[model samples]
Target chain A: MENQPILSVRNLTKKFGGLTAVNNVDLDIYPGEVVALLGDNGAGKSTLIKCVSGVHSPTSGRVTFQGEDVNFSNPIEARDRGIETIYQDLALANNLDVAGNIFLGREKEKSYLGGLIRSLDDKFMRDRSAEALESLHVEIPSLKAPIETLSGGQRQAVAIARAVYWDAKLMIMDEPTNNLGVPEQKKVLELINALRDRGVPVILISHNLPDVFAVADRLVVMHRGQKVTEKKISDTNSEEVVQYMVGALDDTRKAEVVG
Target chain B: MTDGATKNIKEPGKNASKTILLSLMQVWAWVFLACLVLAFIVAVPLVSGSSVSFLSVRNSQNILVAITPVLLLGLGQTFVIISGGIDLSVGWVMSFASVISALALRGAFNAGLPLPLAVLAGLAMAVVGCGMIGLFNGVIIAKLKVPPFIVTLGTSFIVRGMALLMSENTTVIGLPRGVRNYGNESMMYYVRGDGGGFYFFQKPELTVELLRRMDRIITYPVLMTALVVAVAIYALKRTKFGRYTYAIGGNEVAAVRAGVPVERHIIKLYVLSSVTAGIAGFLSMLRFTAGSAVIGDPLLLSSIAAVIIGGVSLFGGSGTVVGTVIGALIIAVLTTGLVMLNVPSFWQFIVVGAVVILAVLIDQTRDIIKNKIGSS
Candidate 1:
């Protein structure tokens, strides 16, 4: 029961007009694990998880969450089932404050009997968001500050805190630390480790081998929309992951596919 | 902050100055509008001459009356603009409303309907006309996902043309006295000059007869206009719909991803804008005792201009109705001041156009400063 996968994707494929972006990729994400999805640009790693997170529907495939086959038309529907996707853009409203952005769609309203009007309980949301950040040890300058005013690391922290607070069972983060400074990168890796400590399943899509090997329990490589290799982080080295990433693994098979 | 500098606040003096200047820019949104008001107060008197006080009670009334329709239309545009869209048809929607009410009142008056009943019918007709246009705009823009500029522009022309055709390109005049009374009736009156111990800021206690003898007066319609502005400001700051407007306008895609019903909210915003147009029409028709197909044409761009000057971003996410009210008032002041200064009415065009451009320039400069501060 402890080893069972929390999320499983079978034969997932996504086609954009003529080209197949994700072709027959399969992944099993177990609870309490950080599975690093490593690939070169356009290797279909991002597209595969976007499918699982409901950013895009699979062209032809199946996704099972907690043993139930599901298809969500949008991120909102998937979020209802405890699947959250943190896009590369972060997707935070720049005009809204940190608390407003966090509780945007799922706002908390004051409930004191019934009334004709329902409004956001500002103090409640702000306090809780403060708590959310504090728990993750992420120090934001101000909860009332416009999100655009924050640093790159701060913005990423806000996004992750939102996902964590929503009770997300499976989280798909696309390059969580891209463009972040060295210290900021360390903070993100610590967050990934913390998620593992809480027994939450995380799918980290990254190109940085150092960051990937630091937190990921298993490493999965994809090339040209196909899964090239999968190995436990302890069972493989950075050199092996690189070979699979650049399509340097299994020379005979690569020649046959190319020809 | 560097690790060594973290313990010393003075080490980041440059960064501290940037924050100071950065926050000053944020405060400029309100100060910009205030400066416009101050300009109205200072320059109106400067250019208009000492004998003709621009701050006179009667002139204030005139300013309020002039800006009522602009403010009414502006309130609607503020909602739509905040949601990352614009209603170019609003000015035409007001004309459409005016015609509907006037024609309905005429029909009832001719058919021997009672005066009160005729007025009610006219108001009903205006409401229904505004509702229908709003729904049409909403459906095309929200459901069909058409760009709002194109959709509203097309509708503006169509509605204005329909008004022209229906009115035979002439004025819909001769509205019933009952319908006109509610709009034109002065709710209260004040003494007409700057006298009887009635200084601009002084409130003197006078006998009833003395009050009656006072020559200067401020009218009820002006008070009602302020009432509308006050209510709109309140609703915007304290309601769920208010926050959603900013949310929707700031980043629509983010709003959608967060589960906001972006399409439905936008539809409601259009509906609200048209209702204000309907009200403006009813009142304007009463004031004029007639309506023409071209009544709202010039106001289309002017009302949008008022909003932009008020500090609401043309880009759609960040602004307040309070700013918009101030904006409409500035145009009223600018136009009224220029006219009193004996500027040619046609050249008022260049003056007003220049102000709009100046406003856009200021908005852009503030944004540039903000981005520099943010990146720095």
Candidate 2:
């Protein structure tokens, strides 16, 4: 309880013209904990995370990461600062192989001709990618197979492997279990637990209540662009969470603002 | 985890063989090319009887020379197409380069510059001028977020007009005599004179005996083309720049998310295409010893056709420079072979069009097969 929060969002607000996507949401993520952000469709879960992950600029608020004020202009800046977001789309280039995607933006290169020519170090990258995937107990027949040829679960594993390889301080996953087979969904939850054990704070966004109950230490529920409730895992069950998700319950009784 | 473990125990061998088969399918362009050569060898002799030879070394050299311009343009187009873009301006950019290089050479000669310097100036002017045109295309296409087809198409017209106006809609001639010799000169020439030695770096007068004896004639342009092709193949396959290109083509959003400089990379791809076009333009001028504004006009589609036939998908994200080489060779051989068999020139279009369609059909089949394998 005495540890300083690794990530703190103070009074964050984001609007798309007249439609306010995320409204004055303040949250803190401590190390080694999985905080599940649960909400219905268009409930602003994605917008709030996007603001923190640098996909979109917040209209008003301050994001403090690791005890420093931070505002990132793009996803790359956030990534460089050790914040990795696995988007809903998975954001993998289908044409590139598993190893290639693992080393996508930051590729290892060997220079020749006194640095006049630089070439991708495919052997080194492939070996490293293989090690990373192996550590995660993820298996694909070939590291050289393009991502598009991999199963959905395999692609998701590759995305997670990339984040793991980069040594992310914080992991943000949007709908990590969506469209995945049951066992694949189980693997992802286990991955979240594994990441938490490694002292990496994870912000998990999901519609699946069982997934939230199974792994998260705390739950933050948002409804109609505002935080509806925050609860510890022991204090709340799925039915109560669903009630909050459907806006049947409001923790902040600002009645006039309730949609 | 257990499912994966079980699958892994059984799937590796199956997966490896399936992947190999898939890659073989992707390389159908090479197989098609070999078949075309074989067909020509078998068919040409039967059609022409004793008058023509399709498998002769001389004819092979001629085919190589003929493929030079198309292959160069196709090499450039291969990059653009693999990056999920098309550069319509390349044809006119080539025309522009030819015209500009010719005019610059003539002016350099008029200014009494030495032949080597004049040639260098002409080559530099052509490359730089066309590169600027490519830069312009890249800016609008990448920064301005204009679609490549529309932007390049617009530039193609402007460049075509500029080429016409600059050359006065005529062939720009009056190049120095050495320019002609430089274009025609070979790396080595064999002469059956007194013990038959090889002539190195010299363009001797062709007597009947020398012509008959000159079996190994490797032109300067051919060697230059080979070097260019080699460098291009290496760049596309081995460099990070090449990886970014494929990534951008595969999924631009994903590439951006991965921290790739997508805009800058796209610009580089367009520049690469234009530079190749520029080189093609300069080489064509040398081959003819004259530069005409319209020299590359008819070649635009053929170059694209070669890329298509070589298995570079118009949708982008997958291709190889070696495939483009095979593609160019296929077109060149088809045209040359048909001519040798006394088929009318119009038939070349029919044959090439059919081959292009066939290539696309094969590409689609590859996709369907890959999907099946991937899903399984």
The top-ranked prediction according to TM-score is 2
Best prediction by lDDT: 2
TM-score of chain A of 1: 0.92
Q: On residues A129-169, what C-alpha lDDT tens digit does candidate 2 reach at each position?
A: 99888877788878887888777778888998899999999
Clashing pairs in 1: B190-B216, B190-B217, B191-B214, B191-B215, B191-B216, B192-B215, B192-B216, B193-B216
lDDT of 2 by residue, B117-236 (tens): 888888999889988888999999999999999999999999999999999989999888888766767878766546456777665567776677675576777877899999889988
TM-score of chain B of each: 0.84, 0.92
DockQ (model 1, Cα): 0.42
lDDT of 1 at A2: 76
Best candidate, DockQ-wise? 2
The per-prediction CA RMSD against the true structure, in angstroms, equals 4.7, 2.7
Which lDDT values do the candidates have, in the order given? 0.81, 0.88
